[model samples]
Target: MSAYSQQPALLDPLPLSPPKKEDELPVALQDIVTAAITEEVLGTVLERHVQAHKPKEPRVVALTADSISIYYLQPVREYWYLPLKQTHTIRIAPLLPVLPVDASETETAKWVAEIKDRITRFTETKDAPVDRFIPPNHWGDWSGVAVFMGFTLLIAAYLLGVGVVEQFVFTTERRFNIAVAVHCGVLIKRSKDVNEMKDLLDKHWSGDSKGRYLWVITSWIEGWRAVSRLRREIARLNLLIAAAEEETAKGTKKESKKKR
Candidate 1:
């Protein structure tokens, strides 16, 4: 009779019922990876809620006195900064999952793989923005102009000398030719051409007498080639100059509009 009647008056109440699973827990964050942790670490635990993800290198860290803590972070232009004052304790429960087996042995390996994948996103297929054309001025200094002019005049003079020589050879009479031959013999007494000329001619003659004219004609042709090449360069320069002028005019128009 006493045993049933006096259970210490069932004092301390019937001992409170155990709390619900969630209620009994302290402030707990199960799979939290700090900002200093790699995304791979976070992926192991938390289910990421992202519509659009920012591309960035992973690096997260946790500051702890004894337990974990979380703080709100403000977004800067390219990064986020954690608030100094406000923070709450977070209870860490378990290590996150192995994110799909990093296959990569080292962090560097993972980073390299990530970088390669990211680079693929920016291949030639992407329609990236391009800058407007800016023509370069390369006409060079007065000294460069002077150097070019000097060479041009020298070539012209050589050409003129050659043409003059050829004309003299064609127009001179028999007496002038004979006189030239004799003068050439005296100047080129040792030349084989002189000996050959003496044999070819009915009378004494020297082929070496024609050497000057031959040299001049060949030089004239070379000079003409140089002039032709210079013409092409001039045409290219003209096109470039015209483009630069057009750009300059457009820039002026824009400035005028701004002023108005």
Candidate 2:
């Protein structure tokens, strides 16, 4: 026989063992399996969860390793990311394109304590009206009382001014004034002032400003346009972050399996 034919087949099937009871799988293992399948279906969403678990990578540059091993018992690294393709695994020398440092044990402990404290406060404060938005407490009830008193005072003032003074007080005028005041307040808060706006345009607006009218007109246009652009950019970044999270989760699962 030829040497190749004499060699045992690498593809030889292994003996099958009987299935174990459902409860035989450890709870942690079950959770891992569930997460992996979920990540497969979710696609992009896995990244967000992965990010939540990942350590903070300090360097801007990518760090590649032949293989990367993260212990389940240790919180040494943030998380181990694995790729989605079943055919390939980072078992040999996993390339860590990015290596992030996790928070120190002391920092993690402090954060956990703070979070627990906040949660405890929230739970304890739940029954108290002082902590609630529409609490049944005295303070909450006072808001309603104040609102009623305000309307009463307003009506009394209007009656005194209109009936006693014989001044024309149209109902529409009051409504229009209120609406204008509310809308104007919102706009004022949303809008940047002239000088600040001008400075913003000068700092970031990349366009020509040749003449006096052109400079003023361009500055105004560019500033508002820049604000709108910035808003859109922020929204785009949020979407990209969401997508990245999904990939990271899938990667983590593969990393876990490779360890096994």
Candidate 3:
């Protein structure tokens, strides 16, 4: 046979005629991948995200999953259901580079070294908060982590007692997207000052964190520094509140003296 004629049959197109279907696409999705996958997959992809990129003792903003819990370090941080039931599409980008079949051990090591370098891309979602304005560090606050609902409730109680939040909310879903942990009451009662704080949070606090392992903020990885920034922000805000109160007091005192 000629060289072209002698090509392996595997390279040739199959001769069988295929059956044709209707041109109309199905309206409903037969499979809900996230839901269907839930049991088979050991956990959600947050594990993959963390395993690849080790964030600062990595305290970032608390996101909403509406009550589903997962141990952050256990490689299953959080999950939510998507009810897409049509011929739509979602794109996924993996953090870690796929190992080349012929890559050397040195190459593998280098790839591992690049994990931290790859963090920003995975983190900077459209609505993801920025990590630009971490306040100056001081001490002794671990309020970075909380039992998601539990912590917010506690804060609501605290703020309510302090008279900051008269009417409050527990979940932050309606206000911000992809939060790690936030002031629930502040979201509910959005004042100009609160908006400024929110702006600071948006620009400074990162949602890329060690993650709330079991909804508790105890996983301090490389992302720990970020938590310190969060703490510093709390300190700065406290100082500002103090300064505002002092100014208000001074103004009142000056007015009283003038009246006298």
Measured against the true structure, the TM-scores of the candidates, in listed sequence, are 0.18, 0.21, 0.19
lDDT of each candidate versus the true structure: 0.31, 0.32, 0.31
Candidates 2 and 3: which is better by lDDT?
2
What 10-residue stretch in candidate 1 is worst by lDDT?
A: 125-134
| lDDT string, candidate 1, 1-260, tens digits | 12212222211111123233343212322222332244443332111111013323322223222122223332333333222222233222111122232343465345434433322221211111111111111343234434445544544444466565446443444644565565445335324333332232312112243533432332232322222222222222322333344466669999999999
Error in Å for residue 196 of model 1: 37
Highest-lDDT candidate: 2
> What value does the lDDT take at residue 44 in candidate 1?
20
Misplaced by over 4 Å in model 3 are 1-132, 135-221
Better of 2 and 3 by TM-score: 2
lDDT of 3 by residue, 97-124 (tens): 4445576768745643443223333233
